[model samples]
Target: MYQKENSSWVKHADFTICDMLCLQLAFILAYWIKNGVGHPYETELYRNVAVVMIFIQLVCTFFNESFSGVLRRNMLEELKKTFEQCTLVCLLVLVYMFLMRVGSDYSRMILLVSYVFYIGFSYCSRQMLKKFLKNRRYEEGEKRSMLIVTVSSNAKNIVETIRKNNYGTYHLAGIVLMDCDKKGKTIEGIPVVAGSEDIISYIHKNWVDEVFFAVPKEITIPEQIIKDCSTMGVVIHMQLATMKSLGKNQIVEEVAGYTVLSSSIRIVTPRQMFIKRTMDIVGGLVGCLFTGIVALFLVPAIKIKSPGPAFFSQVRVGKNGRPFKIYKFRSMYMDAEERKKELMKQNNVKDGMMFKMDDDPRIIKGVGHFIRKTSLDEFPQFWNILKGDMSLVGTRPPTVDEWEKYELHHRKRLAIRPGLTGMWQVSGRSDITDFEEVVELDTKYISEWCLKLDVEILFKTVMVVFMGSGAK
Candidate 1:
């Protein structure tokens, strides 16, 4: 039996003080820079104005509800609110001076300059502090550990979400099944500790930080479970049906009598979206720069051999099975798809929903052989990545015909947006012939996903592409 450790109130108080101190430092610096050394200090009038300004700013921030919950604030939204509050405070101070006929006493230049510097610096400092705390917790192995109480399907989804998101502070300790024949079994390597009856004893004995009730909303005794955990000082989280019902573009709202979690159907968290887009912009830019050099060299060679357009476009299935155009440099003849029918009998590759032809006749005389070996044909996909149609690392997009033949499990690949290069590309691309194996690799990638994995795959892809051993 492991008992969870709780941080003392003094520790929280200290951190809060640190937060306020940092904010105050920003204010002091802004004041000093905006007002020269000649400005009066410690005088009755100066002290009164300083006290009033600070009090009003804090009050306005409170009224804005900026500090409602440490966990509830969206990072970007918080920044915006902070800027707005700071701006309002500066404006109010200006109004006070005008009404009192003391406008000459306070420099307008000082007010404007300090307002900009203090607000921007304070907001940035707060964000940096948050990142520092998150990194420290991760490094200390002190993530918000949770015991999920649910069956495999529900537990699997929660586990995958936590594992995939680096910024999510949750670290799932294990799961507990409520009702099932495999009550004692584990789901995806997480142990199933005990049933409902043993939850209190188990939590008290173990160091459980949070208890996530992933059981469906239909379960009646969830409140009792929440109460039991509450007594033990463990935080409780639950999966609500309202979250599952929302569409991709729907707005989340909390009404007077109702609280619901609405989300996008794309299955991405805000942190995930931020990291993915950041990677796309950075990676896409680097890829485009390199591709430009390659194009300069390859374009001429490709033209000398085939005398056709240096690029190719094809329709592919995107997120949610939407149709989008995918791009590649021309690795085959202009009429490759049309000639595909003629090469069917000669197709050496076999038994895949997607097409893969070895020694393809549709390949151009010289460029096709080199393009497949070096994987240079796929370079143009950076444009697609930039356009938000694909990612630097994700499941390869499928053809329309191939996507149509997918089963429910196969469709899970589409749960994420497709990528230009992924686990399949680096995991012996040409050697892996079994479709099931490919799907398994893709599924595994999705389950154990992380930014680290994406980075590793990208690194390995470079090696694979250079070696040119696996591509047909």
Candidate 2:
């Protein structure tokens, strides 16, 4: 599959971290220049101030997107951007000092000197890092290959544009001519590799990871070619750099060195995803600890009641249909799988896309009923969250058989990683019996996912668990 370039701060974190380091170096130098001190941060006052400054740096660099285009900026641009960011950090610190009435406690000269030194240090480091990154990522050797498709008339301009604005991740593999064969011909020295008829064959034999289509307004891309590329797991990005939003599910993204229209289930910033994953890791760690404790107390009782393994493992579909072994406390008898077929008639869901019954006959009566009611059966999934097979909040994972029976539309719910608790789980898990309603809630969660929405869902999940009403 075309490994979509990493979505977030992961791509440009080096510069952000380097800039913060530069500020620390600047502060150290400023301290020495002003007081000839051995270590400013060793003092309680300066140590506390240093911590606050670090927070300000985070706010300025990450939250404020100060390094949004760091890799693409030229030396002069980097100088301007870095200087502006450093000034902003100092200004925020100044406001903090003023508000706390501690202006007299801190040395103004040290602050001014730190700002000046930070601007110079950060700019140089950023420019050098950017150059090094461009060399390593784009020019060192082989990179992800990109194939450009367009009419012969538009080939030269599109090639020039891609070269000018390429994010340096994809090297031009060659071109494919739609209007006519220009095979063995070079547009801006990028050879025309194929023409309309043989493009698919050429791609089949080549290592093209992504395709960029930049046809004229009047021309249309062949549906067959698009399907052929997609079937081979190659992403086709249509050049739409000069336009604005293209409505729902259409995202304007920079791909293969060109701004293209990428259709996706959701479009969110890398920073937000970074934060979301961070939250998952933190929550997963805590959940695992609690799961261990709960298991100690619950496992023996479960074993005593059912006389089977305390843990249950089943292969379940995860994000994008990737399969993983999902774990839950053994909440049902050993023969539950075999018994499910006979029990299908009693399913609560109208369409039977999902299996839920009023009181599952297979549950190990007392212990199973208690765990399911308390939702403790799902605690083991915290390990899945840590492994990234799941998220803390997402669509419920369907059993392998249920997944196999799903219609095309139902697959959208699994576009994201399955979660321990989710929209449907929080929205009256037992009452909402319609599988379509489950799909609706899951898709709504995916489409409208944000930190705020996730927070609200998490809070509601806590309430639901405490109230003892979960999956029927």
Candidate 3:
């Protein structure tokens, strides 16, 4: 997985901290220059005014996106935006002061001084930072070194295109040729450093920042190379072959100056992604607390009945077929895996890709039945959510064995992190016996996914749990 660099949440947080600190510092400096240090807060009204001004300024900057641009390319524009934001903040403060009948209590001179001080200081500081970044990128050689992975003919076009774009962030490093015989060849002055077979090893040994797979449509990029890049945390961008039809909301992104159609399933903004993760963290905490309380009542009963561990941990395929151990309260006997092979003949699911039985003999007697009915068995997975291995809502993670049987298209369910509860769970998990139907529901969830849909699914899950539907 390519970890998003300079993520929006991080940028916003940085700008917010900088703006707040600068605003408060500007006001303090102005106050000290005007009234001297002895008269910090002359009146209780002054303190109230200061608080209100800070609040209003933060609100204005947030809404105006005053601090949302890249500093190097946006110095003049950002300065103007900052001035407008500060002016708006002052106007709002004046209106608020009038409404509170404290307009006379605060100094107009201080406001005028602070406004000028803030604009000048903020602009100068931003320009200094911009200069520092520019120096670091160009003078200090901080630009990311990119490797283009393709044949000689395609590599020439990609190299030309990238040079034409003049993207300053990434510098051309070399190329990886698909044809083994062209290992020592050069495409548009960039040497072919390695063949396809040695690409992964070469990347591991070198300081390559990102790799662009621009192979022809007929050539298949090996899955191992992608997995290797993901594991090593080296960013990978694959060129999308021209297609007649693409999904709604599909994005075309410029990666290392090459225009590639982004095939992301997440149709969410950066703010939305931040909010979703925050929700997952909060929900996971609450769910874990509930799980702890419930465990007090259920653990002993489960142990007494099964005479083994209260929780079961199994290796499950997670996002992008990455494996992680999934935790659940042990609802089956210790011999469950042993019994599974014998029970394969009795598998009810049409495809045998998944196993589900109405009266599974492997389930521990009373405790298993009770927990399964009420969904208490799923509580331990909140830990997984907290660990970032799972989410509060997504497709169910499949077992390693089950995943091995998956068709290429079936693996699309792993595009997002698996969830504790999802469309499949709420939509009669037990009643739907066919594995294909499960895949269909999972696919539908991915295609139409949003925060609103997650909330709706959560509500439906609550209802389903209350009704004890499909708990068999």
Candidate 4:
């Protein structure tokens, strides 16, 4: 049941609300300054523009990851970032007004002045809020208490790192030096409260919300300590090796009645997974609507030219080796599968774990060129996404044969569900000739996944499609 702490957006949700209020106040004040003491909401044109501004600002905040590390940012960095976000929002507002043909009906000065006021108001509010939180949020008994268990050699470093990184979440209660008798001594100003012999007794006497075990390689950690901590209802964290050795993302979970250490580049909280699925559902519905429209035109062309059903379905490997039937518009002839073996020698990729080529002959001559160039062939994957067999953004699913040939490290791409469009598709798939390069991009996406990153990828996907860098 263990999961990551709150995401930045969830943690600073109040701050997001505060930002909206600041925008409202600043815009109202600007409207008064521009139009003799009246409000923007009173007018239809200005009121509509104001609503658009709010929507654009929310998108900017979420996609730009504006609130990330806000607590740690110094005043200058905060000021710069705040101004940049405000400016970007203003530019987007201008773009929207122009597209809607409402720019001429509005006072441009209102936007300029609103930006000015928003910068000052937001910066001051954030600084004040951060100061209050840093000073008062976890003062006295509000902070959760943590106990540390490590050898004397590693005690000071661990204590310092915890104190430095944890904002107001934890109060270091005490330390237990297993390899030495350092009772009543202090490391980084935290007292050594107990030795190994009296650890369980100390927990019984004092309140400890968590215990972190950073046992050294030479030290033999007692199995009784972990059981005792669990019995006492205290969260236990066994700190593993350096990030270089064990990878960045790590998790602890009960597997088949055994506690095991799992390391990958895609550790996630249940909340994050829920949000990702929500995005998939919303996007899937919209994509399916578009797919239905495209099928009306493209399906007839395929049937006229190719001599089979207009849809194609193949069993593709999904997340964690699960197989699912992936749907696609039938762009190739019925014997396309039989022809793939003959085309293997012509693969454009080196060390071809993946198959690709120029001017694939199995493609229906005129209709295939038009649909594949327009990426109309991929529309049916929206159904796969809706069925929960794929995501809107993830690694490309491989065929059953391709999956069987995957090396140990190459299988890491399947850590998450495959997608309709992914890092490989957007980042110059046609230009890339190395199969390893595709794996690298997918691994990078898995390691650094966030909702904001997903938004960014979707935007990039749009640009890639519009610019004629269509799917292969």
Candidate 5:
């Protein structure tokens, strides 16, 4: 997470704002240069047209990663990207003009001249801005600090590799020796300040930006130590000779020519994620409208039958181990939680990490069975999604007690936000009683995720809900 923020290609909001400003100015300047001052400025009309044109170009720029190259360092690459963006922007505007049958309203010569000025000015502005930022960072004495974790035997090779590909982004601050007697030794001018046993304390006391684990194959780092770094929000890099141990889901990224495996739970593209969130917002609003109507009858029915609150909420673990209340319409008796302990032995799940029973005595008679079958009890969760506590499709949230019993590997499923419905809900949920199988399915959904997959699962869920195939 920290590395993502410090990446050289990460675009800045100021840079984007300046980029748009430069493009707009270039358009006006081109108009004046081509048609002379005799032509009316059309300030209002042209400004509006420029705004719409810039918006389209921004979309095209993002898709093409036009702003993803280091400006001052990669002038040639930046030039190429600038040309590509300019050509794409022109093509899109032409397509729009043709589609709207307004091609004759705009002058083709002005566009051609504007493209030339836009490309030239954009590249020059970026280069100047890059120099300004470089001077500022130099004056402030800011440099990305790195702490290398390796044995004395391989420290030289790691240091050399870093030097070869560093690209002026990182400078070694210190080294933590692993399985070595050289605690006070120096490796390539950097002092080996601590051994494996004292590494955690060193990390806590030092201002380390990144920790690179470059140990030998046989020497395994403790899982708790890794988790500690993650909890501290420090970026970690692990260099491996082979990818056999790390799962295939890992993405291999090169840093200064050194290859390392990087893993993330949300592997889908940013555009897809944005669309998913938009869908969730839209779906949540619609669901809440339906909930308002359903509550008219549900509130009366549930209260008259069970003599308790019409809704139920429980503490559930969300993404990154945060806790939040998950709301649901009352589908069980008021004493359901109290009676759960006595019914523990009745749990049907084989490798039990969760409790489930086909004929639980706690349910609120007819209303419970009907709502559970129809999935109407889950309607209240739309509020959770709208509040950003959950998603429209993700792994089901685990209860507090269930989370407490989780093993180290079991927590992998918590990397993403919990969802109202997911692969488990649509895929014979009641028939599957093994906790391990549930984890497998959740992991599979994350690894194979895409916008289309979410839509497909949602469609299957509607069918399952209507048929009452997977509810108990």
Candidate 6:
């Protein structure tokens, strides 16, 4: 079911390598300019260090989202991300030097100059390349191949937007109707070739480069349609309630080994799975390394105050409705679960399924309040992440009891693995009093989940933890 597009992977690979080489050369030039006659030193150690540093920086640059959707990115956004990535690289270099105990070996002056020059030159290079590509595509009459997969008013609006924009780059290939009633007709001059059932056949027959889905959310097509399109090697775009409501940062993921249709902005990609796993491994290892030290200090304090186990384990719903034991530093009394029923009448929250009490009396003595407030209770979940029952970022898993109460729609949150921290946790854990709001946020996160989003959430999570905002 695969067909080739005008752009080839070879071209992409060549462009990627060229960009990397250009950046490397820019770094080298900056180094020379900064060090002058001492530029070409004969130290093998320095050369080895330089190679390793450059490789690490390049990888980090990619991870920080330096080279993504190069064609469609806005210049301003690209520049901002570039500046941030450059700063990150500089900081890494400083950290690397400190760790290696060789801060004196490398010239600080050279590093500073390289940082400035590399950032400016790299940004300019990307901008110039973007403009050049845009011009070339225009000159070559390289129109963006697009296929509309709906016959709704939303589809009409999408057509209107494409028409009004008049960028001359996008060419409407055809439209596929979600409902069979509109089959064998044309909408606004775009041919309605087939229905959702025949979309695979239609795509195979046509030279479609991109597929635009404007189908209503009520439609019950198998999620496989999106995955089929992705596996068939086409870029898929969907129109949600409003453009603003669309999380541009939502990630497209392959569910059940098939790519599901998702919004453009995502937290995880097939390409990023490796990096995410690596991060989980490294982060988990580091966390495990400190687990003993933390347990030692906190265990006795908790026992002294609460007279209970130092750790708490509870059954939480994980990916695919699976139940798993989640570990935490015991933040509540031994009989906290038993006391939940007694406090139900005093519950200030009113949500469909979730239970919450801002001022619950179930908390343990000294450490319970402190640990819960700072989210130190969640640190042990790093073991869960390491064990692959969870991730560094994903929807928060519900309690087993909570899972039993979930509606079918809410079960969609289990479509992906649960996380240690998530959008809901960072946004407003305690303040977000509505269970539906929590589910909505989770759905939003899943629909638009990506590695970048994970990174952003992790960053926000750090801020939230430090600020102790919305913690109970």
In terms of TM-score, the best-performing candidate is: 4
The candidate that achieves the highest lDDT relative to the unseen native structure:
4
Query: Which 10-residue window in model 5 sums to the lowest lDDT?
Result: 133-142
Error of 4 at 105 (Å): 8.2
Better structure of 1 and 3 per TM-score: 3
Tens digit of lDDT per residue, candidate 1, span 1-472? 2344333333234334444454455556656776645444455555565666766666554333344344335688768756866777778877777887777876666566667766776576667766665554463266677888876567777777666543556676777777654556677777888777777788889878888777776665556778878887888776655543454335546878777554542343455567767899888988889889999988888888888888789999987798899988898878888887776666543454666767777888777888878899999999889888999988998898789888887887776779978898799787776677778888778766766688889899988888887887
Candidate 6 local lDDT, 382-469, one digit each (tens): 8999999898898888888778888887887777889988989988988988887888898889877667788899999999989999
**Candidate 1 displacement at residue 70 in angstroms:** 18
- Name the regions of candidate 2 deviating beyond 4 angstroms: 1-57, 60-216, 219-247, 251-260
Q: On TM-score, who's better, 3 or 5?
A: 3
TM-score of 3: 0.51
- Cα error of candidate 1 at position 150, Å: 16
The parts of candidate 6 lying over 4 Å away from their true place are 1-10, 35-46, 61-65, 137-268, 301-308
Give the per-residue lDDT digits (tens) of candidate 2, residues 167-249. Answer: 57778999998899779989999999999899999999988988998887777777999999999998888765444454466
**How far is 434's C-alpha from truth in model 1 (Å)?**
1.5
**Best-to-worst TM-score order:** 4, 6, 2, 3, 5, 1
The TM-scores, one per candidate, come to 0.50, 0.55, 0.51, 0.75, 0.51, 0.68
Superposition TM-score, candidate 2 onto the true structure: 0.55
Error of 2 at 66 (Å): 12
What does the lDDT come to for candidate 1?
Answer: 0.72
Model 5: per-residue Cα lDDT over 240-348, one tens digit each: 6566555555776797988677766546557667878998999999999999999999999999899989999999999979999999999999999999999999998
Q: Which has the higher TM-score value, candidate number 5 or candidate number 6?
A: 6
State residue 1's C-alpha deviation in candidate 5, in Å: 29
RMSD of each: 15.5, 12.5, 14.1, 5.2, 12.5, 8.2
Clashing pairs in 2: 8-270
After superposition, candidate 5 runs with Cα above 4 Å error: 1-262
